[model samples]
Target: MYGHRKNISDVRTPDRFSYPPSPSPSSYSTSSGKSTSGRSRVRGAARSVAGVFVACFTPPEEDTHHHSSSVYGGVSDTFSSTSDFSGASDSTDGRKRGTARGIYGTRNDSTHMKEPGSVKFTIAEIHYATKNFALALKVGQGGFGTVYKGQLQDGTLVAVKRAKKIMYDNSIGGEFQSEIQALSKVEHLNLVKCYGYLQHGEERIIVVEYVPNGTLREHLDCIKGDVLSFASRLDIAIDVAHAITYLHTYTDHPIIHRDIKSSNILLTEKLRAKVADFGFARLAADVESGQTHVSTQVKGTAGYLDPEYLRTYQLTEKSDVYSFGILLVELVTGRRPIEAKRELKERVTARWAMKKFTDGFAISVLDPKLEKSEANGLAIEKILELALQCVHSHRRNRPIMRRCAEVLWNIRKDYKELLD
Candidate 1:
């Protein structure tokens, strides 16, 4: 329910999600500036990228020679335009064809890939599952289209994302494919699971496991009732961190979740948070060991986007950390990331939380309903401190998601002890 409305257009709208690019030498440089070496390493990475990229079936695209970083310091949000290449797609006569390179380095002629655990439901079956797209079953709305609450023949409940179809438009077609590429390959307790998808004519729908509870954002909203306790918030934090850590470190192919906000964090009936919506996820494989960041356009919710990433487009795992930091602030304060209704300085929760935290008034940012129990006080302060560090200006200063999770885990344990 926390998902955003995604579009197939590149007109700078909310749903026009773009893929992360492997940083080209001309496009990205370190804080120390190593342009000469950076280019040389990326050239090698290109070869490696081609090999793996071939195996991951996505729409194919010719190379995008976007070198727009020369302007605005070193931060180039070049792919923010309609001309942006989606890395894996090409526009020909129109209907985008899915392509793949199989295990033996042999190219497969099949338009669709059929890997184990990768399932495709018939259009008829999906129609029945979604109850013919009944309005009553609509669970959420986004740029992508309406999300429906569905049930399969076996009584398995699912969340079906009915993507907005465009006539002869190629942009959203690629976004839909990129989303499937990442979600189909990776699995983690903290990540949403994609069950299958259906392509019925121009209509595209992705079916995923339906999480019973709403989004973390909904839970945080006071209007939704004071349902989240301090412990629950901490648990959500750890869950998000673990999910991001899994994408960063545990995956065979590391992923960078370009969009990480409370809205993308869904809760199960148990309130276990699962990171959903891989609309902006990027494979971190094409990067060289030394050039860990991917160069992509700055595309994310305003307040959660990393200041460093926005300026540099040098997207790293740290970018996710920055967004997660904002999420932590949300948990701590029960506020939205961007609050236009608030005062000027307090408009951004992260910035507001940081000022308050650094000034030794971090306690002031706590949710009013948290009750300020003596036991959770110190732990809450520690969490706020960690979140402050995560939002540090320099990406280098932020702790990795795993480290963030460990700290939260410890705090949760202590909180549990206090409850006991």
Candidate 2:
């Protein structure tokens, strides 16, 4: 789905010492055992950022407290491990919940959903909605799972996401439940709503409100003549920025969306963006008021991964900023993040556009399908400038999500002022 598949060279699997992975698309089973991708020999500076999550988590075979487990990749069996969600925030000072304005603010009032297993739907109801997972209802597929269009008894449409393995009874269930917990307490206009979930026999199904329009990636690369206007693309970018701002600043604690990419963003009839797939979301610790980052093994799609985070293994909210920067480049250029069929210099859109942008040809990156005008051209320049800052090699140079949203909102306002 990323693009035309070609033979990719082996880069080696991840390192086990990085710590056991939890349930979610990024999960890795303890059975996989050991990792040595040449990256392990990274210079001494790399050890300084080698992550702290390992202290709180250990592979089941090595620890007496854990049960054996596996997810799509697999997860840790212990509840106290990173496999389960738990962080302390004692108070909510900003952001609201369940609405657009102050959603992350709801932390002060959240009921604190402690049990994901409790939020369940019946399998029969799932069958009634998805018509028993008929091929016609299928909408998407990937390493994580398959998504299908479905309708509930009340006639409300929904999206049903099923596990890759038909019978994912035990270890994989960790990820199933982890996703539920992540989606349980929070609600936001820019977030995909989780209606509930169902489990029968070996099958685990997640039910979320259906957004009819399709993924942002599909809209960006449509084969038909239908083209997304420059204004429309700008709006989509703002919507996603707002959603990430909500996640980072609101909630009981900051939630790091390990994977932030165009394909994960779903669009509605209005083409509004909604962030989905929280299986890899992790709670930012509230142990200290000044905590700037969490140490965790690198886990995310290749093209969008943050270079700083990848080298140091010190995860931070800015990592998402770097990935969002890639999404911005995609929106402007209409190119896949990692297109290999092209020349090496042109393969990575970020690098290609960055070089062009530095040479003062940033305008060349705008999607040709979009109409041009003086006002829009100025707006596009500002967007590209912000994007370059986001993809900065050093995390300190990247703008925070809230600031990014505010900047995009100002760019939107420029359109109205210019019209007047």
lDDT of 2 by residue, 36-132 (tens): 3211221111222112211212222321233222121222222212323333322332322333446433232113123322447788888888898
- The whole-model lDDT of each prediction reads 0.61, 0.61
Backbone clashes for every candidate come to 13, 9
State the lDDT of candidate 1 residue by residue for 273-353, as single tens digits. Answer: 888877667776333333445656555555566766655556677778878877888898998776779886676666565
TM-score of each: 0.72, 0.72
Give the 10-residue window scoring lowest on summed lDDT in candidate 1.
88-97
Worst 10 residues of 2 by lDDT: 23-32
